[model samples]
Target: SDIVTSVLDVSQPCEVNIAIYDISGRCAMERELEIDCRGEVEIELDTGKLSCGVYEVKVLSNAGGDKSRFVVVR
Candidate 1:
């Protein structure tokens, strides 16, 4: 399994949303976090529960409208 993490820069305190999607493009897990300006965060993803295939991890900063994507393999 693979673990994914990312750092985001937010201008203000807001909610951050992270979602993990399986090979079928279905969201498997969702997490929300509160971040402050210029704050950094790390997220550990558990890929063991997923099948041996490709997965997509998306991070979104709700307040700043920022988004990022990552690929994971199990």
Candidate 2:
């Protein structure tokens, strides 16, 4: 699966940490990406092994961080 989101107000290039957590707060998937502060970032997630449920996504970088929730139907 793919997750696309935007990082706003970035002042410089940096390394961003993206992590997906299950409802129990356990880390299910994680990846590190280097971006040039271009405003939007698109990421690919391997969800084949993940169970159908609600999950949280955390995006962290030197500029800032954000959290959002998602659901997997299959």
Candidate 3:
């Protein structure tokens, strides 16, 4: 499974930091994504070796950031 989110109102092309953490606040995954400044952009998290459980997703950019939770079921 993958974690999907959107980054909107991007003013310029830049790199955004995407991180995923488990319920215990342990960092499970991380990635640096290069995105184009469109009206709205869809970002998908590469689950990789993540296990099935509840996790939090954080997307941070120079513009702003957001946090949310998702479940990865195998």
Candidate 4:
């Protein structure tokens, strides 16, 4: 089982867009998240339903955006 964890640093409450893309650039999963002023918040993505392969995680917010790559193997 693989899980995607996103750690965010926020100064105010806001909505965030979290998405996962497969190697072919297809969206595999996505979630709209909410965060408080808490300096760091962690969001978990359940990848149990996805096939084993390379994937990309993207996070979008008013502050900025970030992207990361990951791999799953069973």
Candidate 5:
């Protein structure tokens, strides 16, 4: 199982894009959300279809973000 945690200090309403990619840089999953103002949110990832391996996570927003790597094991 995997989860995504996103924190934002938005000054106005906007959209955020989140993505997960395999080690080979293939997109595995992606989500776009609409949020307002400033807040923090957690998203549950359905990783049941994925095989055990390493992956990269990313967040795209006006407030800037970082990418992280993670591993899933069977």
Candidate 6:
């Protein structure tokens, strides 16, 4: 049971990409998210479907072209 959260700073009308990868270095889930320009946006991840191990979470913004990473444990 792990939760992964992240925030991105973007201008008005932007799209963001979120991805989750398992310990085997393969992508497990991915989503294309849209964010409104103003404040921080948060996303939650459910690790129930994943095994008990370390996983990688990646967040990317289309407007600012930024990439960030997070670690998830179950």
lDDT of each: 0.67, 0.76, 0.79, 0.87, 0.74, 0.67
Weakest ten-residue segment in model 2 by summed lDDT: 1-10
Per-residue lDDT of candidate 1, residues 1-74 (tens digit)? 46666666666777888887776889888888776556565657666566665666677765644445555553
After the best TM-score superposition of candidate 2, give how far the Cα of residue 16 lies from its true spot, in angstroms.
0.4
In order of listing, the candidates' clash counts read 0, 0, 0, 0, 0, 0
Position 36, candidate 5: lDDT: 62
lDDT of 5 by residue, 5-56 (tens): 4454555667888798999999998888887655555556677777789988
lDDT of 1: 0.67
Model 6 residue runs over 4 Å out of place are 64-74
Candidate 4 stretches greater than 4 Å from native: none
Give the per-residue lDDT digits (tens) of candidate 2, residues 1-74. Answer: 54435344445778988898999999998888877756555566667778889999898987789888888885
Comparing candidate 1 with candidate 3, which one achieves the higher TM-score? 3
Q: Candidate 6's residue-wise lDDT over 1-74, tens digit each?
A: 36666666555667777787776879988888777666666667666677666666777765545445555453
The runs of at least 3 residues in candidate 5 whose Cα sits more than 4 Å from the true structure, single-residue gaps closed, are: 2-12
TM-score of 3: 0.79
User: Which ten contiguous residues of candidate 1 have the minimum total lDDT?
Assistant: 65-74
How much does candidate 4 score in TM-score? 0.90
Best by TM-score: 4
Order the candidates by TM-score, highest first.
4, 3, 2, 5, 6, 1
Q: What is the TM-score of each predicted model, taking all chains together?
A: 0.66, 0.78, 0.79, 0.90, 0.75, 0.69
**CA lDDT for candidate 2:** 0.76
Model 5 lDDT, full chain set: 0.74
Worst 10 residues of 6 by lDDT: 65-74
